[model samples]
Target: MSAWFAGLLLAAVSVLVGCRIADTDAVTPVPQLLAFLPWLLVPTGTGLLLALLGRWWVGVVWGVVVLAGLAWFIEPYGKDSEPSGPAVASFRVLTSNTQFGRATGALLAAVRQQRPDVVFVQECDNRRCDIALRRELAVAYPYRQSVDGAGSQGSVILSRFPLEPAPGVPAAMGMPGAVADVHGHAVRLQLAHPMPPVPGGLGPWRRELERLRDFAAAGRGTPTIIAGDFNASQDHAAFRRILDTGLYDAARLAGHDRAPSWPSRTTPVFGVQIDHVLLTGDFSVTRARFLTLTGSDHRALVTDVTLHRR
Candidate 1:
C-alpha cells in the first residue's frame, strides 16, 4: 500500500510538471525548467517502476497517468496522418545561426544539400560570413538583404525568391526580417535570434520575445514565418503565446516536435529544442526536421511547406 501510494504521488507530480511547462514564465531559473518539461518523463518512468512493485492495478493506473502526460506534452510532435488533397504551391525554408559566423563550410554544405528556397541566418554580420556568402551562396541565392553588416540587432536573409523589405515596416526592427515572393506567394519571414534566457539577460530576452509577438499580432493576415534560435522552448509561456499569435510551429504541425535543435553535440533524445520554424496563415507543413551541422553548438531546422490556393 505504501508503494502504491508513493507511485500515485509520483505520477501526479510528473503530470503537473509536464502540464505546467507551457505556462512557466521566465521569471527565475526554477520555473524556466518548464522549457524542458519533456525531461519530466524520467521521474514519471520511475514512478511506473515503483508502482509495479505494489500491484497490477496500481501499476496500470500509474502507467496510464504517466503516458497521458507524455502524449499531451509530445502530441504536437506526434506522427501525422497522410493528407488527402494536393497543395497549390510548395517550398523549402531553412534557419541556421552559423554560431557567430564561424561554421562557413558546414553552412555551405547544408545549404547545398538542403537546397532551401529561402534561408534565414543569424549572427551573420561579419567578414568571414561575407566571404562565404559571396563565394558559396552568391549565385545560388540571388536576392539577398542584410546579408553582411547586419549587426547584432538583426539577421541576414538569403533567398532564391525575390526578397524585399516587408511592406509598411519603416526599417528593419528587432529581428532580421523581409518578405519573399515564393513563386508568386508573398510570405513574410524573420530571423529571430533573441537574447538568451540567462540570469543577466532575462529582461532583454522577454522584451525580444514580446517584439516577435507584436510582429505576429500586427501581421495577422500575412503569411508569416519566424525562424531562428528563439532561446526559449515550447514549454516557455512567452514562446507559447507567440504561437498563440496565429503561428503554427512547423515541427509541431508535422508531428516532429520532439526533434531537438540545440546544444547539437548532445544526444538528440535529451537535447532541448531552442531552434524553430514557426508559420502563420494558410501554410501547410509537409515536412519538418532538425539536421546535424558541424562547427556550431546548434542544429539546423528545415521545413517544407505548401501554400493554399489564393
Candidate 2:
C-alpha cells in the first residue's frame, strides 16, 4: 500500500514537470496528458480531505501534493495595471473570427458601430462574399487585403490608414499569417487558427507556429501586433511561444484577466479567448475588452492602444 501511494505521488510530480516544459515552447504539442491528470487524482484528493480531519499526516502531505500539482497545471495570472497613456488618443483595433461567411449583416453592423481604425476578420469564405459589407467598410477603411476564396481559409485586414501589404504576408492554411505596415507603424499581424490536437494535425499546427515565430522575429525592431483565433488556449504551448517573444498581451496588459473571447454567442464555458492581440515596442494599451457576439463562435476583441512617439 505504501509503495502504491509513492507511485501515485511520483506520477503527479512528473505530470507537473511535463506541463512546465510544454509552457516554455510553442512548438510543443498541447499536453493532453496533463489535462487528464486532475481527473486521475480526484480520488486521492478526496481521500486526503477526509483524512485531514482525523490528523493523518499522510493525508496532509497528499493534499499539499495535489494542490501543488493543480497549481502547476493552471496558467499564471498576470498582475493587473491601469492603462498607461491617454485612452482617447489611442488607436482602436477590432479582431473577430467570423466562422467563415455567416451573418454578414450582423458582422457589418458590429464593424460599423465600433469603427475601429483597424479590423482583422478571420475564417473568410469565398462563396458568401458580402459585397455590400465590403462596400460599406471601404468607405471607412480605404486600405484592405482579403483573400476570400475556396482554398484560402484566410483573413482580411481593413484599415482606415494607408496599409502597404508586406510581401509573403498572405493568409495560408491552418494558421494564416499576415503583416501590414499601418501608417508607418510596422505592425506585424498574424491571423493564426492552429489545428486542434485531436485532428491528427498537431505537427502541421506546430510548423505553423514556428513560421509565425520566424515572421515576428524578422520584424524585431518594429511595433508588432499579432492577433486572431490561435485555437490554442492561454495554457497551450503555441500561445506561450508568442508570449515568450517579449511581446505584451494587450488584454492582460489592460487588466482584463478573466476575459475569454471565443464562442462569442455562447456562454463562458465555450469561451476561453482563443482570439488575442499581442503588442511589442513603444506602445501602451489603453483598454481591451471582448465585444458582443456577432453570430459567430468567437467574440470580437477590441483594443484601444496608444503608440508613444519616438
Candidate 3:
C-alpha cells in the first residue's frame, strides 16, 4: 500500500476520533464515544510511525491533526494558575461504585487507611450485599446515610462529620446523599449516578445531567460537592455543562483525567475514566488520585480539597 494511503487512513481516523464527544440536542441520537477519545493517542503515535515509513509530509499532517486534537479536546487541566488563599479546612473524600456485591475486607482496609472524611458508594443498594457495609463503615464514619433504591446499587454516604439530609430539597439524582456540616459551613454533598449514555439510554442520561445542573441553580442552601460514577466524562458536552456551572472535577484539577478509571486496569491500556469527584467553587482541590479496588471494574476515586468560603 502507498505510504500516502496509510497516512490518509490515519488522518481520517483522527477526525473520527475527535468528533465523538457531544453534549447537545442536535446529537442526542449519537452514541457517546468520548470515553474512548484518549485512545486517539494511538493514532497520534502512529503519525510518528508513518514518518519512519517514508511518508514524512503525510506524517507531519497527521501529527498536526492529532496534536491539535490533544490541545483542543484533551488539554491537560490544572495547568491554570491556582487561586491563592489560606484553606479554611482540608478534607479527604472518596467515591467508589464498590462493584455489585464484592464488599471484601480490602475495601474496609482502604477506608481505614485513607480515613476519608466523606465516603460515597454507588450500587450498594443490594442490602444483602452492599448495605451490609454500614456496620463496618460506622466504625470509622460515625455519621452515615444510605438509600437502597428499589433495585440496582442504591447510594450511600458515610462521613466523619455531621451529615443531614436536606428536607424539601430534591436532587433527582436517583440515589441518596447528604449535606455535610463542616465546622458550621453547610456543604451539600450528593452521590451522582447518571444513566449511562448508551444507545436507547441517552435520553435519560441527558435528563439526569440536566437535573443536576438545575439542582445547582435552585440555590443550594450550602456549597455542594458531587462525587460518584458519573458514567460520562468531560468529553461529553452534557458533563461539561455541569462543570461549567462553577463546579470543578477534582481529577482534572489534579491532572488525573488522563488516567482511566473503568474497565479495570487488568487491561489498563483500553480503560477510560468515567468516575469523578466534582466540587463547587467553594473548594480548591489539593490532591487527587485513583485507588485500586478488589473485584471492581472501576478504580476508586480519592481526592483531598481545601474548602473556601465564598
RMSD of each: 4.5, 4.5, 3.6
lDDT (Cα, tens digit) per residue for candidate 3, span 1-310: 4466557756655555545433343343333545666566666666556655675775766677666766676765323325454567789999887666464455677788888899888766455435467766667788877766633446678898898875322333445667788988888877788778777767788888777777666544457888888888766667777777667788888877767888775535667788988777667887988888886778888899888766
Local distance difference test scores for all models: 0.73, 0.62, 0.70
> For candidate 2, what is the TM-score?
0.78
TM-score of predicted structure 1: 0.80
Clash-forming residue pairs, model 3:
123-153, 125-154
Give the alpha carbon lDDT tens digit for every residue of 72-120 in model 2.
5554433333334433235888887777657455678877787888877
In what order do the candidates fall by TM-score, top score first?
3, 1, 2
Which pairs clash in model 1? 77-255, 77-257
Which candidate gets the maximum lDDT versus the true structure? 1
Q: After TM-score superposition, what is the CA distance of residue 143 in candidate 2 from its true location, in Å?
A: 0.6
List candidate 3 segments past 4 Å from native: 1-31, 44-63, 77-85, 167-173, 267-269
* Cα TM-score per model: 0.80, 0.78, 0.83
Best by TM-score: 3
Q: Model 1 over residues 14-83: C-alpha lDDT tens digits?
A: 5455446445563566345566767766666666666776665656686667667666765453233333
Better of 1 and 3 by TM-score: 3
Candidate number that wins on TM-score, 1 or 2 = 1
